[model samples]
Target: MTGARTPCINPRCRRTFKADGGSDEVVCGKCFRTLAEAVRSEHRRYWREIRKWDRRILRTADNLKVTRMAAIRDRLSWQLALHWDAEIKPRLIAPDKPESLDAFLEEVGL
Candidate 1:
C-alpha cells in the first residue's frame, strides 16, 4: 500500500512525498540529499577560509609582541564566531550536522 503523503519540511522545497510507515522523515529524499551536499560544501569552504586566516595570523605573529599576538588571536576568534553565528548557522539543515565549525572540523578529521 502507498504511504501517507507529507510535504517536505524545507521551506524552499515543500514538495509532497510519500511518508514511510516506519520513518519520521519530514523532507523528500531529493531535498534531503541536496541539503546534505550543501552543508558539506559550506563546511569545506569555512575550513578553507579558516586555514587562510590561520596562515595570515601566523605570519603576522612572528613580528608581534606576546600581548599583541594574544589580542590578534582574540579578535580572530571573535570574528570567526560572529561569522558562524550570522552566516553558517542558518544554512544548516541536516539533522546530524555539526552545530559549530570546530565540531565540523573534528568530524571530518581535519
Candidate 2:
C-alpha cells in the first residue's frame, strides 16, 4: 500500500498489489507462488506418467525373447511417442529441453 501498485499479469488473478517501483515483476507474489506450484505439480505429474511407461517398456523388453525384441521395442517406442505428442506436447511450453518453472509459467501466460 506504500509503493507503486500494479495488477497481476495472470488473467485469472488480476488483483492489484503494491510493488517496488523498479521491480520487473508482472504477477503478484500470491499469483506467482500459485503458478510456480502448479508448474511444479504438472512437471511431477508428467514425469510420473512417463516413468510408468518407461517401467512397462523395461518389463516388456525383459520378458520378450530375442526374436521378438525388436518388434516389441518398436511398438513401445511408438506408444510412448504417441502419448507424448497427443497428451503431453500440447500442455508443455517447451518439449525439447527442460526449462525453469518460472519460464514455464511465464510461457503459458500464467
| Candidate closest to the true structure, highest TM-score | 1
Runs of candidate 2 with Cα error greater than 4 angstroms are: 1-64, 94-110
Q: How far is candidate 2 from the true structure (C-alpha RMSD, Å)?
A: 16.3
Model 2: per-residue Cα lDDT at residue 57: 59
Clashing pairs in 2: none
Error of 1 at 79 (Å): 0.2
lDDT of predicted model 1: 0.59
> For model 2, how does the per-residue alpha-carbon lDDT over 6-97 read when each residue is reduced to its tens digit?
76555556578666675443545564354346554654565566566555656664545533655554665566556545544343323343
- For each candidate, how many residue pairs have backbone atoms clashing (under 3 Å)? 0, 0
List candidate 1 stretches off by more than 4 Å. 1-64, 93-110
* Per-model TM-score on C-alpha atoms: 0.31, 0.28
